[model samples]
Target: MADLDRSSDDTSVDSREDTSQDSKLEFTEDEETLIARMYSLLGDRWSLIAGRIPGRTAEEIEKYWTSRYSTSE
Candidate 1:
């Protein structure tokens, strides 16, 4: 029926949106704080700890750390 087709189309659209979102990684406030603090306390040497978090690159983590410190100073 036409109704079924519309419902399926909606589901497909929603799925595509979700997939697109998942392609980029987002950090929570807590995660940002934790990463920032860890970097601050240790300084640019986050390689060991960065391995634990999923979807985040070490470069991104380091850039965030530097940006936070630069603004605070």
Candidate 2:
């Protein structure tokens, strides 16, 4: 058993999602506030909004803003 080789070296191909649709997203209060304030201030301007939050991408900020706002209206 010790000499058997069963695992692939490519993590990108072998890895799978450990959770399902029911999995919850975990966020800090600061992250939540950052996104909220960015939206409130920038009104979904991806460039400006993403700039305010550290390490956030423009696409991600835009998607979150739209998803939250569209459902409320």
Candidate 3:
């Protein structure tokens, strides 16, 4: 299991640069405002939240939120 996790991490690192350059994960200022509003209104229902935002999917939103906002503690 540790090896599996490590391999996945390695893959992510290898792809990060190429993916980052072409990624659609970065939200615009207006989009950020709208997402915050939607998040407040909808809570953790990312799919519904994503539906309200064009050009963004639930997975992308969830990944961004997890990486940016979620705390270990």
Collision pairs in model 3: none
Error of 2 at 59 (Å): 0.9
Candidate 3, residue 49: lDDT: 87
**Lowest summed-lDDT stretch of 10 residues in model 2?**
17-26
lDDT of 1 by residue, 1-73 (tens): 9999999999999999898666535667877877867765777776754875666678767766666666653
**Candidate numbers, best TM-score first, in rank order:** 3, 2, 1
Q: Which structure among the candidates has the greatest TM-score?
A: 3
Model 3 over residues 1-73: C-alpha lDDT tens digits? 9999999999999898678746687878887787778888888899998898877889888887788778998
Tell me the spans in candidate 2 whose CA falls farther than 4 Å from its real position: 1-9, 12-26
Model 2, span 19-63: residue lDDT tens: 321122334578678888867777767888777766666776666
The reply for model 1, stretches above 4 Å from the true place, is 1-26, 71-73
Kindly provide the TM-score of model 2 when superposed on the true structure, using C-alpha atoms.
Answer: 0.53
TM-score list, all predictions: 0.49, 0.53, 0.63
